[model samples]
Each structure stands twice: as C-alpha cells, then as structure tokens.
Target: MSLVLDNVSYRYPGSTHGLHEVSLDVRAGELVAVIGPSGSGKSTLLKLVSGLTTGHTGRIVFGGQDMSAMPVHQRRMGMVFQNYALFPHLSVLDNVAYGLKLRKVPVAERHRRAQELLGIVGLSGYAQRGIGQLSGGQQQRVALARALAIDPQALLLDEPLSALDASVRGHLRDEIRAIQQRFGATTLLVTHDQEEALVMADRVAMLKDGRLLQIATPRELYEQPASRAVAEFVGLSTILPCTVCAPGRVDLGFAELHAHTGSRPVGTVLHAMVRPEHVRADPAPGSVNRLQGRTGAQRYLGALTRYDFEVPGAGKPFLAESARPAAEAIAIAPEHIRLLDL
Candidate 1:
C-alpha cells in the first residue's frame, strides 16, 4: 500500500514545536528516507503516519484512506524502533510471535508465521535463544522480524540500526533493504545519518527546523542542491566567492572559470560550489584553466588521498582528492572548474 502526507502540519502547545506543512508521498515497494538533524521533525512525521500524535491540519493518507482518523493499530503500519524494544524475558520465537498471538491467530499458525519472519531476517536458528543472548545486530533483526510478522502494509523504521556497531549497521542496512524489496512493502526510514539516506533510499526528504527543504533522489540532492544550505548539507563542496567577468565566465582569485550561470551583476559576490573530486592537482602544460598553488596539507586516506591547497588570495582554501596512490603534484586548471550560485 502507498503512504502519503498531504500538507501535514503538527504543532506543540507552546507554539515552538512540530512539523510545518510537510508534504510527501511513498509508493508501494519504494524506500524513502526522511533525513535531517535532530529536532527537524523526522520523528514527528513518523508519529503522524502511525497515528501516535494527532490534532493537526492536513491529512495522512494510506491505501487511499484518510489515516488521521484511524486507530494506531488499525493503520496496519508496522514500526521498527532504534532500541529494538523486544521483550527481554521472551525467547526470540515468542518475541516475533507476540503480535500474531495478540491478534488471536491460532497458536500453531502464529509460531509458523513467526518462524517464517525470523528466517527472512536470517535468524532461523535463533528462535530458541533468549533475547538477552543476542548481539545488538541480532536483536535489531528480531525487531525487524517482529514488525514484519504482522504482514503490515507499510514499514516505518526509526533509526533502526543506530544502536549497532558500524560493521553491523552496514550489514543490517542491506538486510533491511533486501527484506523490504522481497516483501514489496512501502517503507519510510527516519535517520540523521547522511550516508544511510544516500545509500539506502530511493529518494530523500531533507528537513530543517521542522520544514521540508527538498525531496529528491540521492543524486539530485547531492549534485543539484536547490539552496546554499541544501548544497552544504548534502555533500562535500568548496564554496568560493566569485564575480561575473562575463556570460559563461567567472573570475576566481586563481583562475577564470567557464560555466552555466544566471544573470548577476558583474560586481555581485556569488558563491560557487565545486566538488573535491572535480578538482585536479597542478595541470598539464596545455590546460586552459591551469593554476599553481602550494600544497598546504596532504593526507593518505586508504582509497583516496586528499590535498589542501592555499589559493593565493581566496579567503577559503581549495581541496582536491585523487584515487589510489594520490598524485604527488596538483593539476587544477580553469576549464575543470564550475560556478555554482545560491
């Protein structure tokens, strides 16, 4: 089933809290990650969908029905939390089966369905183990299994892997995606981790101060950010001050760049963003944009070596990166530069 928020807004009693006119849609079988810093309304958005909080304007729609009026349990949306929230006293099997039992499914049928879910989460033999015996990752898998056992129309995950170690987090992220894909469940992931949003979601909604900044695919958000804040938040960038020399050309302290840009007065101070990878070390002899500068600090970072260079008069330094064995020399030139305006 599809899930959608149509111009949804929530407010706290004091007037200084909640989501503001946020609108988004989640299609069946698609994974959409709501990403932002803390207090940006990610959790509030989830509560609205699950009917945990109410008394706001706009509608929460699910499967073509208005969900705002539906009881939380009637929404048929399963939720997985950051802390696992499993019953420590229950065996893994029972923890996964608890929901089915509560719904009054036959005892045999509940156990059968719960075991199936455990298998989907790669916890086949773990059914008999006590919850306390499981590792953080295993515990999260159990939580996922429990959520899935209900055969929910949609899955809402709140920082689902935050409690696990880095390695476990990576593994579980893939696992969650796989399970969701297999079941074709409409899924919404709430997280503050940029990497998690970039790698896991079909699309992302970036929020700030309880407002939706932008919603787009990971590529769109990272490469064509709509604002200075969006660009700075989505990826690594070097925003340098530049003045328009003419159409398609702008002058930086070190080089003249040719790029697509809008009409700005010649003396206007505009910010230009360039990705580190787009930058090269000292250029080849015939490069049009070649600029020379002293390398300030260079460090080897396994897959890539990063260099910090001091541009003669630019207030901020330039950063460039090279793959594998980093270039001993810098090769930046004017032609490789792009002028980004915000």
Candidate 2:
C-alpha cells in the first residue's frame, strides 16, 4: 500500500511552531525515510500520519483511500516507537499478541500468530521470557513483532533503533530492513540519522524547520542535491562562494575552476559544492583544478583519513579524505563540483 501526505500543515495551539505546507508520497512497498535535525517536525509528521495527533489542514491518503478523517485504530497503520513500548509485565508472546487480542482473535490463534511473528523477528525461543529480561535489541524485536501482529497496510517507524547500542543498532538496522522487504511493507521511517536513512530507505525526505526541503533517492540526494541546504544537510560538503566566469566555469577568487554552471550568465554569483571524498589529496603532477594548500590537521578514521587543506586566502580549509595521509596539494574534478544558487 502507498501513503501520501498532501500539503499537510499544522500548528500548536498557542505556539507558532509546527509543520508547514508539506507534501510527500511513499510508494507502494517502498520505504521512505524522513530525516532532519531536532525540532524539524520528523516526529510530528509521523504522529499525524498514525492519527495520534489531529487538526492538520491537508489530506492523508493510504492505498488510494482518503484517511484524513479516519480514527487512529481504523487507519490500519502499525507504529514502532523509539522507546520500544512493550508491556514490561507481559511476556514476549503476550506482548506480541496484544494487538491481536485487542481485535478479539481467539487465544490459540493469536498465540500461533504471535509465535510465528516472534520467529520471524528471531525471538522464537525468547517468546516466553519477560520483557525486562531481554536485551535492548531483543526488546526492540518484540516491539517490531507486536507492530507486525496487526498486519498494517503501512508500517510507521519513529526512530525505532535509536535506543540500541551502536553494534546492536547496526545489526538490528539490517534486520529491520530485511523484515520490511520480506513483508513488502509500505513503510515511512522517521529518523535523525543520515546514514540510517541513506542505507535503509528507497528515498529520503529531508525536513528543516518544519518544511520539507527535498525528497529523492539516496544517490540523487547525495550526488545531485537540489540546493545548498540539501547538500549541507545530507552529507559532508565544502561550499565555496563564487561567480560564474563562463558557461561552465566559476571563479573562486583564488582560482577559476570548471563546473556545471548550466545557462547561468557571466558574473552570476553562486556556490560551488563538493564532497570531502571527491577532493583528491595528491593529484598527478599535470592534473587540472590543482590548488596549493598546506596540510593542516589529519584524522585517521579507520578505512580513510580526513585532511584539512588550508589554502592561503580561501577563508576556510578544504576538507579532503583519502586512504593515506594527505600531501601539500589537492585537486577537485570539475564534474565533482556541484553548482548551487547562493
């Protein structure tokens, strides 16, 4: 099933903060991740879709059905919260079966379904254990089982793995994506982690200050960001202000570089954006776009080393990444430089 939010707007009763006119569509059987900084309305968007909050001024549709006026229980959307809201007093099986029991399923039938879901989440043997006895990862699995028990048309996950440790979170992240794909569930995942969104979602929706900035596939979002805000938020980037010197060229004060300045007139001010990984620390002697910058600081990050290349009058150092230590100069390819409006 697909989920769509059409120009949804909301405001707090006495405050001026809330989601602005936002529109998004999660395709059928596709996982769309909503990511942004704190107070960016990530959680509010999830709450509105799940029908936990109301009084929005737009349509919320599911599977071609207008669900704007539908009650929470009738929305047929399953939600997994960050806190893993499992009943501590209930055993794993009972916790997973709670939703089924609420719908009046027979004891034997609900238990059978619960057991099946537990097995799917890799908690079959722990079904009889108390929630408090399980680790954070295990508890989250039970919470997932409980949400899946309802067999929702759309699965809503609000930072579901945020509470787990790094190691456990990494494992559970893969597990959740596998399970989601296995069920072919239409999912809307709310997260503040960029890596999580990029790795698990088919497309990413970036929100800022209650507004939807951009929605695109991870590759598109990373490599071809729509604007400077989108470029800076999605990943590490060095944005340099410049003026269009020609049809496909920009002057960065210190040096003029070739870029994809599409149809912009000469002397038009713009920003040249490039990712750290795209900056070559040591280019061949006769390479293009070469800049002389003394290496300042270097940080070893396991597989790659991050270097700060400080050019004489560039205002700020250019960040570059390579597998080894950086030399005195760096080069940036014209194709790797993305031009954006200032």
Candidate 3:
C-alpha cells in the first residue's frame, strides 16, 4: 500500500522542544530510503507511521484510507528492526511462523508458509537451526523472512544491515532489495548510510534537525541539491566560502572559479562546493582552470584513489579523487564546481 504523511509534527512532552514537521509520500510498490544524521528524526518518523508513538499532529493516509486512528497491529505493515528482534530460544521455523500463529493461521498452513519463506530467503534447509546458531547475516535473513511471511501491505526496515560485517552487509542488502521487488512490497528503509540509500532506494528523503531537507532520486540529491546542508549531507564535498564574481563565476581567495549552481546577486557570499570526483588532478599544460598545488595525503581505496590537493592561499586542501592518481597540477572543469545558496 502507498503511504502519505502531511505536515506531521511530533515532539516529546513537558518542555518546548525543537519539533519536527514532516511530509512525504511513498507510492505503492516503491522503495524509499530515509537518511539523516543521529537524532535527526529518522526513527521518530518510522515510529509515528508504525503506531509506536502517539499524539502526532498531522494526517497519515495509507492506500487512500485514513489511517490516523489505526492501531499498530491493524496497520498490517511488516517491520524488520536493526537488532534482529528474534526469539533466540526459538528455532528459525518457529520465529518465521510466529506472526502467522498470532493471526491463528492453521498450524499446518503457517508452517508450510514459513518453510516457503525460508526458501525464498535462501535458508530452506536451515529452518530447524536456533537463532543463536546462525551468523549475524543469517539472523537478519530470518528477520526478513518473518516480515515477508505476513504478506504485509507495506514493509518498514530500520537499519536492518547495521549489525553485519561489511561484505555480508553488502550482499544482504541486495538480497533484501530483490525480495522486496519479487513480492512487490512498498518499502521504507531508514538508514544513516548514504551509499546504501543511493544504491538501494528509488528515491531518498534527507532530514536534518527535525526538518525535511529534500526528497529526490539519488542523482538529483547529489548533483542538484536544494540547499548547502543537502549537498553536505548527501555526499563528500569541499565546501569553501566564496563570493559571486559574475553569472558563471565565483572568487575564492586564490583564484576565480567557473561554476553552475544557484542564482544570486553579484558580491553575495555563498558556498562553492566541489565533489571529490570533480577535483581533477594532473591538468594538461596551460589548461584553462589549471592551478598548481602540493599534495598532502593520498590513499589507494580499492577501485578508487583520493588525494588532498592544497591550493596556495586557499587555506585547507580540496579533496581530489579519481580512478587512478594524477600528476601534481590540478584543474577543475568550470561545470564541475557548484555554488550553493546557503
């Protein structure tokens, strides 16, 4: 089912706290990732939708029905938690079938369904194993199986892969996305990992300090952010202070830069942001934007490389990265730089 929240506001009682005013729409069968820093109301948004919290000040509509008063159990939304909230004492089979048991699906039918779900999650033969016997990734699969066995209208996941090791986490996230697609479940994944959102979600909603920053496809959020905060949050960027010199240029302390982003009056102070990938190293002789700088720190990170290129009089270095390391002189394409309206 699709989900919608309009002007939803929530706050803890007693003192006047900095409240959150949230609004977004999740289409049926679409996967959306909610990302933010710690305490930016990501979990609170999920809690309000799942009926774990009360006294919300706005409307929640699900599948075109007013779900403002619906109770948690009645919502029929499947939730997979970060900690794999499974019964350690119970066998995998029982845990997967427990939700069905609560709904009083006949014993034989529920077990049959649970077994099917286990197979769907690639754990067919491990049904009899206890939760403690499985690895973190295996336990997470079991949690997913349980959530799926319900055949829920919508699925909610709260950092489901946070506990797993790096390689396993990467593999399992793909598995979860595949399963969600196969079942056509409308999913909401809450995560602090930006790459996870970019790789897995069809659209991402960015939040900060109890406010919604922007909601867009991963590319839009990265390439055309609405505010300086959005650019800083969505990816790695070198945000430097600059003044607009003309329609397509901004002046840093050391040199004038050409860019495309934001429309503000001349002489207005703004932030000039350049992504690590846009910071080009080893320019051709006499390149238009060529600037000489000393290299500070460089690292070979598997498929990619990163270097700190320190421009004279620009204070700190701008982060430069590429598939392979380049020569000392760096050049930035005019279109690669972005002026952010703060």
Q: Among these predicted structures, which one has the highest TM-score?
A: 2
Off by over 4 Å in 1: 253-255, 262-269, 324-341
- TM-score, ranked from best to worst: 2, 3, 1
Off by over 4 Å in 3: 15-19, 261-263, 323-326
- TM-scores, in order shown? 0.92, 0.98, 0.96
lDDT of 2: 0.92
lDDT of 1 at 13: 85
lDDT of 3 by residue, 1-342 (tens): 789989998887874443377889999999999998887889888888889887888898899887778899899899999998999888999999999999999999999999999999999999899998999999999999999888899999999998888899889999999999999998899998898999999999998887889999999889878889898888888888999888878888789877663567788888888899987778789886788878888899988888888889998888888886666688889888877776
The collision pairs in model 1 are: 280-331, 281-330, 281-331, 281-332, 282-330, 282-331, 283-331, 289-333, 289-334
What is the TM-score of candidate 2? 0.98
Best by lDDT: 2
- Candidate 2 error regions (>4 Å): none
Candidate 2 residue pairs in backbone clash: none
Q: Write the per-residue lDDT of candidate 1 for residues 79-141, one digit (tens) a residue.
A: 999888899999999999988888999999999999998888889999999999999999999
Q: C-alpha displacement of 223 in model 2, angstroms? A: 0.8
